[model samples]
Target: MHNYTIAELVKGLQSKQFSSVELTQHFLARIRQFNDQYNAVITVTEDQALQVAQLADQRLATGSAPALCGVPLLHKDIFCTKGVRTSCGSKMLDNFIPPYNATVVENFEQTGAVMLGKTNMDEFAMGSSNETSFYGPVKNPWATDCVPGGSSGGSAAAVAGRLAPGATATDTGGSIRQPAALCGISGLKPTYGRVSRWGMIAFASSLDQAGPMARTAEDCALLLNCMASFDDKDSTCVDREVPDYSASLNKPVKGLRIGIPKEYFSEGLHPGTEAAVKKALTDLEAQGVELVEISLPNSDLSVPAYYVIAPAEASANLSRFDGVKYGYRCENPKDLQDMYCRTRSEGFGEEVQRRILIGTYCLSAGYYDAYYGKAQQVRQLIEQDFVKAFADVDLIVGPTCPSPAFKFGAKGDDPVAMYLEDIYTIATNLAGLPGMSVPCGMVEGKPVGLQIIGNYFDEARMLNLAHQFQQVTDWHTQAPEGIL
Candidate 1:
């Protein structure tokens, strides 16, 4: 039951091969057995999950149940869950539990999906590695010593470890794709406004977008179908109609143009990663897909521009967490000023604080025009670059990260090296386009992800290509040793 994909689970439930309660129990038991090993789950709502499963079973008994009825999934901690700890992996909000469900959580509930628990994340969705998580870093299932990619790492790790079939995750900049690559799972970052952000905790509001993470593209597509919906509550949510993402999974692949950016294959990419991406491209080519060399001229400036823009937004968004509000207030402050200073400094992790400082500095009156304004201009240029490349290509393909999962603390001393880890993925967020990562190959036993970048609202096409590739290769099905 734990190993079954969401699609298979759906069928099994429909056929009454197992009740939702039974399936939920199997996953609950697995979480109990393996969570300590991976630190993937931060909370276990066994009692709540079982109770929900009973309701799902009742709905399943009816002929007209929701699409994901009886499916159990995890949520990244960044999303608010009513009556459950919605810590966002930071001590600041460790004691905070929301009274309302995030739109993503509400959507899953509407599908009759049982919530397993919340997964850890980098505090406030900052950091390229999960090391900044206040709950402690989520270890990569592939190699316990290796770091899973950041912010969304726990979601990716939980899915990869088979603790859940699928989970919700967000990407401010490559948080979903990078971890999915390192943890050997399929994760999607939908077009910025495709999903509602009403109850999701903000990081870089303009760049943050939530999507699904699972072992297969088929599962991801199914999850995405439930995850995306326009909500008026969120000002950033798009009003466009949400399509059935799984409907196009088997779409024909012949003659589809895939762009290979020269910058993605340039210096600093690990040799193993480049080889794996090339082989994946070749496999697609063999299936009649056309590979075209393209140039994203302004892509080179994406990292610098993103750092400036994201932090600037983050600074403004996180200001609400000051001691005057509900989260983590300092005790016995000499005054309100002392309280605000101590609360944030003590509540946020080092990485979160560092970004906040950088953001505050950039947004300061004297520096705003020089740093924030200039970065916004560069961001526009980067978006234009993608617009130009997509003119002749259906999608763009590249390595999700410069390398596979690195050993914990490998780049802790040098933040620039850590920041560059997301060099390949930040552009998608900057452009507010959809992107996904699917397991393509392995490097030194760690998985490599092949990133697919699609035009806005073109997620179905991206999933179709990913599904086609998976059908020809077993990479997406591969699990970490001892996981099963």
Candidate 2:
């Protein structure tokens, strides 16, 4: 039951092979046994999960259950879960519980899915590695010493460890994909506005887009069916009709033009990762998917531009967490100003403060035009590069990260090196395009992800291609030793 995917679990529940309660308990027990090693889960929510499972069983028996009726999943902790502690891996929100659910959480409840727990992440979704999490870093299930990619590392680790079949995660510059790549799973980042962001606890408003992480593309498709919905509560949510994402899973991929960016195969990319990605491309080419060598002229500038834009947005979004509001407040402050300064300084982790300072500097009155304004302009050029590439290609393909999972503290001390971990993925967020990472192969026993980028609202097609690739490869099915 623990090894089964969401689609498989759904069928088993519908056939009465196992009750929802039984399935929920099976995963909960796994969490208790394995969580100490991985540090993937933040809160257990055992009582609440079993209660939800009981309701699902009742619905299943009455034949009124939705497609994913009895499925269990973990939220990224970035999403507010009403009474559940919605800590964004930061001490500031460690004791704060939201009174309302994030739109994604509400969507899962509507599908009758049981919430298992909340997963750890980079503090305020700021770090490239999960090391910055206030609860302690989430270790990679594959190699305990290696770091799971951030800020959705917890969700990716949980799914890879078989603690959950799928989990909800947000990607603002590869949080979902990088972790998925490192942990050997499937993760997606939908186009900005394709999924509602209300109650998601903003990291970088313009870059943050919620999606799913799971064992297979098929499972991700099933989860996405419940997650993608327009909500009036979120002004950024698009007013577009949601499609049956699973409907196109079996679609043929012959003659699909896949653009391989020349810039992606540069000096920075690890040879092992590059070799694995090329092998995956070879497999796709054999299936009649045309590979075209293309160039994203502005790709080199993505990292600098993203650091400016994302931090600027983050500075504004996180400003609400001052001691005056409900969050972590200083015990004793000499004055109002002292409270604000002490609260933020003590509550926020080092990485968060670093980003906030950078963001503040970028958005300062004197530097706004030279920094933030220019970065936005550079961002438009990056988007234009993608727009032009997509004219001749159906999708873009590349290594999700420049390298496979790195050892803990390998690049932690160097902020620039840490930021470059997301070099290949930040552009998609900047352009507001949908992207996904599928397990392709392993590099030094760590998994490499082949990133698939599609045009705006082309999630279905991207899933289709991923599903087709997965059908012929067994990479996605391979789990970490002792996981099963």
Candidate 3:
């Protein structure tokens, strides 16, 4: 029961294999048993979940079921849920109970899906490890001493730990893919504008995107279909047609042209991770897919460019949390200025402050053109690299992160090392393309991920390829030992 995927669970529900309440209880039981060890969940709405599950069962009895009706899923704390605490993993919003649901949350509710509760994340969606979460760091279920990557670490940990079949996560500078890679689960960051940002907390508005994290590519496709759509509230959302994402899962890769970027395989990548990616590519090749060497010369600058642009956008988006508006406010301020300073100082975590400082410096006068503007130009160049590479290939592949999950606190003090955790994934966000991480192999008994990147709005094909790879391998289905 615990090992069933989303699709399988949906089938079971439809066939009356188990009641929705019973299914919800199974996961809640698991969470009660193991979540304290991983700290993946911040809240558990068992009563609300059972109430919703009962309604879903009634809806199914009436033959008014949506594709994912009665299924249970978790929401990242970044998304606002009516009457539930939407913390964004910060003390600032720790007490915030939104009066309304986020567009994604609303959509899920419309489908009759049960909400398990909110999962923890980095403060203001900052940091590469879960340590920055105000609730506490998430332990990697595979190795208790290692870190679960962030800012969506809780989402990744929950799905990987089988606490939930899938969870919603947002990525701005690799928040989704990096953590999914480190945790050895499947995660997708849809193309910018592909998913609406109506209620998701902003962090680099131009780059932030919400998507799905699950154990398999096909499962991600189902969740992505429910999550992606145009919302009038988000002006940047593309008003394009939404497809039935699950329809493409069985597509063949007989003539698919795969790109092997030289820069991605060059230096900074762990040999074991590289070897695992290579083996996965070999498996694809055996399935009649063609591989071609492609070049992305400007890829190396992705990190520096992302740091400047993302922080600049983050600084702007985060400016709304003044003491007067909403969120944390200081006690008995001397004046308005003191109120602002105290609120921010006490609200934001260390990594968030670090980025704020970096953003403030780059966007400051005399440094704007030298830093921010230059970074924008490099961003365009990086996009051009993808354009040139895609012209000759159908998709690109690489190791999601440079290495597998690392020990907790190993890179906490070294900000640069932590920033480099997204080196391979940041380029996709910079280019505003869709990318996914699928379980490939394990290193030192920890799982590694193989990343598949696709052109803008080409998520269907990327997911198809991922589904094919998963069909032949069982890595995604494997779970941590001595649990469940």
lDDT of 1 by residue, 263-371 (tens): 9999999999999999999999998999999999987799999999998899899989997757798889998899899999999888888888899999999999999
Off by over 4 Å in 3: none
| lDDT values, one for every candidate | 0.93, 0.95, 0.92
Candidate 2 per-residue lDDT over residues 238-302, each given as its tens digit: 99999999999998899999999999999899999999999999999998899999999999999
**Residue lDDT tens for model 3, 78-103:** 99999999999999898888999999
Can you tell me which runs of candidate 1 are displaced by over 4 Å? none
| Cα RMSDs, all models | 0.7, 0.7, 0.9
TM-score of each: 0.99, 0.99, 0.99
TM-score, model 2 to reference = 0.99
Q: Which is better, 2 or 3, measured by lDDT?
A: 2
Name the TM-score of candidate 3: 0.99
Off by over 4 Å in 2: none
